[model samples]
Target: MYKYDQYDQALVDARVDEFRDQVARRLAGEITEDQFKPLRLMNGLYLQLHAYMLRVAIPYGTLSSPQLRMLAHISRKYDRDYAHFTTRQNIQYNWIKLEQAPDLMADLASVEMHAIQTSGNCIRNISSDQFAGAAADEVADPRPYAELLRQWSSFHPEFSFLPRKFKIAVTASDTDRAAIQLHDIGLQLVRKDGQLGFRVLVGGGMGRTPMIGHWVREFIPVSQYLTYCEAILRVYNRYGRRDNIYKARIKILVHELGAEEFTRQVEAEFAAMSDLGLDAPQAEVDRIAAQFADPEYDAGAPDTLDRSDPDFAVWVDQNVHAHKHAGYAIATISLKPPRGIPGDASSAQMDLIADLAERYSFGELRVTHSQNLVLAHVRKADLYALWQALAEADLATPNLDLVTDIIACPGLDYCTLANARSIPVAQKIAARFESDLARQRDIGELKIKVSGCINACGHHHAGHIGILGVDRKGEESYQLSLGGSGAEDASLAKILGPGFNKAGVVDAVEKIIERYRSVRSGPDERFLDTYRRLGDAPFKEAVYG
Candidate 1:
């Protein structure tokens, strides 16, 4: 995990002081609600339907045990006793008081975390593969570059206010766990001919309009990526639409100006940037990289796991992933419990995770984009003990990529932008399938994502089965889409016909699962595979009929 240096600490402290004044002004009636809106938003504070929501950034989803414990304390002390982990790998506290927000910000600053850029038009928290450092097949750890970008983008003068919010993600793996293709800028760290660089993609995003980013540059050397990023943003700032909020995103601009033309303009901009010296010197990136160095591993640590216990074995099989080290495994803690809220972790749960991270993972954990937590370096020999601890707290649910592990956003229940409630539908689907554990397991590697609206906060556009809540006249209606994925093979899901009522949505999902089971070549063929092979016709017919 990257620790904040003096500069980082000073910047955050200054922000806290500045925000404290802002909050005081608002509370003292020196600034009205209208005046405080942008100020609050810039600090990652949102006035929700019921209360203020504070989104705290967990940079690239990496957290120290102390940071995790602080988050737990915040949830327990200030708001409700839980927090929601988001698709962007950030955490949200839904019941915040405006007056106490500055105190919360100060508390976060104490732990070297903040809500800065988690919201607003500036570059959001730079995200990457949660398995970045541990994944077996990755070319290199991507978080170093992600952290570099984070440092570069934080309060960047030129990009402080873009036409729309921007997102950037990095990954070094062929498996694409970070969903880079759906970001505003996706960087695939690559090494070619002994030179390390990135295969860059731009313009990908999801909202009302979902898009897979187009290839902007085949390669940008690591030494020049920052300059290239500046060039891309400069091109976007110059021509991206400002009149219509809907057309303000760079993705919309890229679509309007053809990808080839956009690339040409960016290249021209890049050529002009060499004289500006925008690229960081090698030493700076080296400094950041050193912070992400691998933890100490016992060379003689046991590689074997005793899976004699079927229940423990099931968890190990489902949640544990291959680590780069032979003796260590990456264990995913499923936040999706039976019929429970998808991403909400109680304070106790957070504390337990922190303790587990300390005991089994060098005091560190990674938050997956799918709303799960990962103990990235757990020893294989301690698997059973870890499983037992997690199970006791109801954290060990053996559904990693299964149908029951649903991803859902804070829909109408919390988000003011939502037309429908997303939590109930997710709960319904999980509960429905969890009834028959074997049947659920039979429908393997299925991802069900639900969003309260078209904002796609839950990444509905990237699910094997996607559900979007919409306002139908005056009632909540759920729309379904099938065959989308956020993995290496990225594609937007296609809608399956008419919207359904809450009850009907579960039935519709059940019908699709049955259709996939009936049509798949074998159990190895996933729900996504079945949908892609056969298309939506069979699933659509099964649902609408």
Candidate 2:
């Protein structure tokens, strides 16, 4: 977790003060709704269909136990008792009062958190792999880079107002847990010639037009990260479509200009900025890296891998991920309870996670890109005890990367742009496959993502099974997609024929899963492998024909 320095503290404090006055003016009728719209959005406040929604940034999805406790306190003190975790790795309070927003911002600032760049058409939160430091496959932790970008982009005069909301993601593993390919700018940290660098992907986004990003630069040395990033944004800001909000994302720019031409433009900018000394000093980089140093571990500790508890073993197999440390495991706290709202955590649950992170883990928590919480540095020996504690807290669901662990957005509940309710659909899917042991073994690896609209906030286009909600007249309908994946082998999901009505959509999903179960070579083979082997003919037949 990156601690706030004086510069960071001052920035947040100033934003809070600015927003405080803005709130007062709005309340006193000094500004009209139209006038207040951009101001509130810049502060991450949205006037939803029912009430004002405040999205607080978790910055690369990292949170301290104290910060988590503050979130719980805020949720309990203001708004509703629960907060929805978004795909951007943020938490949104859906029922915030307009009058209390300034106070809430001040409270968040007290915890070294804020809603800056959480909304509006500017550089939003820079996200990365939630399991960054703890994932065994990672070459390097991506959070420091994410934190660096956050510092560079937050309130940056050059990028304060862009054509559209921009998102950046970084990862350091072969597995694309951060869904980097779907972001505006995605960075995969890699090692080349015994030095760290990044594989940069740009112009990748989801919305009405969903396209997996194209590689803009390969092996960009880490020393020039901010320079190259600025180059990309500068090009986009200069030429990206702004006449229509629909065509404003960098993805659209990539589409119109083509990857080759876009690469040329970005390269030109990079060349011009090279001598400008845009790279942070080595000392600053070390400072950020030091903030992510590994915690002390007891060297001669007994391995906790031989635990006899079946549930604990199941959880370890499903929920626990490989850690960089020998004795540690990254524990994923699944928010997917049986029939519960996906990614929605009550304030009490949030506090419990905060406590567990402090006691069992390393006083650090991460909000995964999959919309789950993570206790990133739990010792393997303590996993069973952690599981017991989490089970009591209803956070011990063993459905990580499984069909039951569905990734969904807030859909119709809070999103005015949503066509249908997504939470209910996600709940129905999870409830349909509620067996723990059965799912742990049977489900294998599957990514099922659903979104309320074509905006693709839930990243439906990247799921093995993607569901998109559409409004046909007054009724809600859904379209199913097949073969989509957000990994090293990234590909956009293809739509499977006509859309289904609300009731029919669940049955459609059930039918697809049933077909997968029957046609799979063995239980160990994932749905994706089977789908790749057998193609969509069998699925289409079982689903539609």
Candidate 3:
């Protein structure tokens, strides 16, 4: 984990003081709602339907035990006993009060965390692969770069007020767990001739107009990484639509100007700035990289888990992942329990997870984009003990990447922008497949994402089975989409036909899964793979008929 230094601590403390003053002014009737809108948004506070919502940034989803404990304390004291972990690798407090928000921010700053850049039209949190350092198939850990970007983009004057919110993600693994293709800018670390570099993709986003990013640079030298990113951001900041909020995303800019022309413009900008010294200094990069050095491990630890208990075996097979190190594994702690809210972790659960991370994972953990938590460096020999502890805390659910492991937003239940309730749909779907573990295993990997509105906060655009909630007159209806993915083979899901009522939506999903099962060439084939092979016709007919 990256520890905050004197400079980092100073910056956060100053921001907390500034926000505290602003909040006081607002509550004293010194500022109107319209006047305070941007001010609050800049600090990651939103006025939701019922109350103020505060989103806290979890940079690249990494957290220390102390930070996690502090979050638990905040939930217990200021919030409603729980916090919602979002798909952007952030956490949200839905029932925040304006007066208490400043205190919350101050508490967060005490633990080296803040809500800056989690909202607003400025660059949002820079995300990375959850299994960054521990993954077996990664070129290198991407967090150091993400941290560097975080430092650089914080309150950058040039990008302070862009057309809309911008998101950037970095991934080093062949498997794209960060959903890089769905971000404003996506960087993939690569090695060519034993020299490290980046493959840059720009303008990929999901909103009203979903788009897969176009590759601007096939390979950019590591030395020019920051410079290249600046060039892309400059172009978007200058030319991206400012009149229409809907068309303000960089993806629209890339769409209007062809990829080739966009690349040409970016190249021209890079060429001019290459000599102006925009590249991050090697010393700075090395300084940040040193903060993320691998943790010490015992060489004598065993590599295998005891599978004598079938329950342990099931949990192991589903929740554990192979690590780069010999005696370690990446353990995913499921937040999606049976009929439970998708990413809501109680205060007690947070404390327990923090304890587990300290005991087994070097006092560090990572939050997944799918709203799960990861003990990224757990020793394989401790699997049984860890499983027992997690089960006792209701955190051991053997449904990683299964249909029951759903991704859902707060929807109409908490969000003012939402037209329908997404949580209930997600709960119903999970309950529908809750029983029959064997049947779920047979179904294999199926990603079901639900969004409350067209904003795509739940990442419904990238799920194998994407559900979007829409308002029809006064009632809520759901639209189903198929064949979407957010992996290395990124693609937008296509809508199936007319919308369905709440119950009909679940039935339609079941029918789609049954249709997939009947047509799959093998049991190991996933829903996305089957859909890719058979197209959407079969699934569409199965749902509509």
TM per candidate: 0.99, 0.98, 0.99
Ranking by lDDT: 3, 1, 2
**Candidate 1 per-residue lDDT over residues 1-545, each given as its tens digit:** 79999999999999999999999998999999999999999999999999999999988999999999999999998899999999999999999998889889999999999999988889999999999899999999989889989999999999998999999999998889999899999999999998999999999999999999998898889989999999999999889888998999999999999999999999998998878878778898888899999999978988888999999888888899999998999999999988679989999999999999999999999989999999999999988999999999999999998999999999999999999999999999998888676787788899999999999998999999999999999899999999899998999999889999999999999999998999999989988888888998898889876
TM-score of 3: 0.99
Tell me the TM-score of model 2.
0.98
RMSD of 3: 0.8
Q: Which 10 consecutive residues of model 2 have the lowest summed lDDT?
A: 435-444
The C-alpha RMSD of each candidate to the native structure, in angstroms, is 0.8, 1.2, 0.8
> Model 2: residues >4 Å from true position, as ranges?
none
lDDT tens readout by residue for model 3, 1-545 = 78898999999999999998888898899999899999999999999999999999999999999999999999999999999999999999999989999899999999999999999999999999999999999999889989988988999999999999999999997799999988999999999999888999998988778999988887997889888999999999999999999999999999999999998999999999999887679898898899999999868889877899999999999999999999999999999988689999999999999999999999999999999999999999988899999999889999999989999999999999999999999999888898878888899999999999999998899999999999999999999998899999999998988999999999999999999999999988888999989899998899887
Against the hidden true structure, what lDDT does model 3 obtain?
0.93
Which model, 1 or 2, shows the larger TM-score? 1
- Candidate 2 residue 373 Cα shift, in angstroms, is 0.8
Clashes of each: 0, 0, 0
lDDT string for model 2 (125-200, tens) is 8888988888888999888888899989988898988999999999999888888888899999999999999999
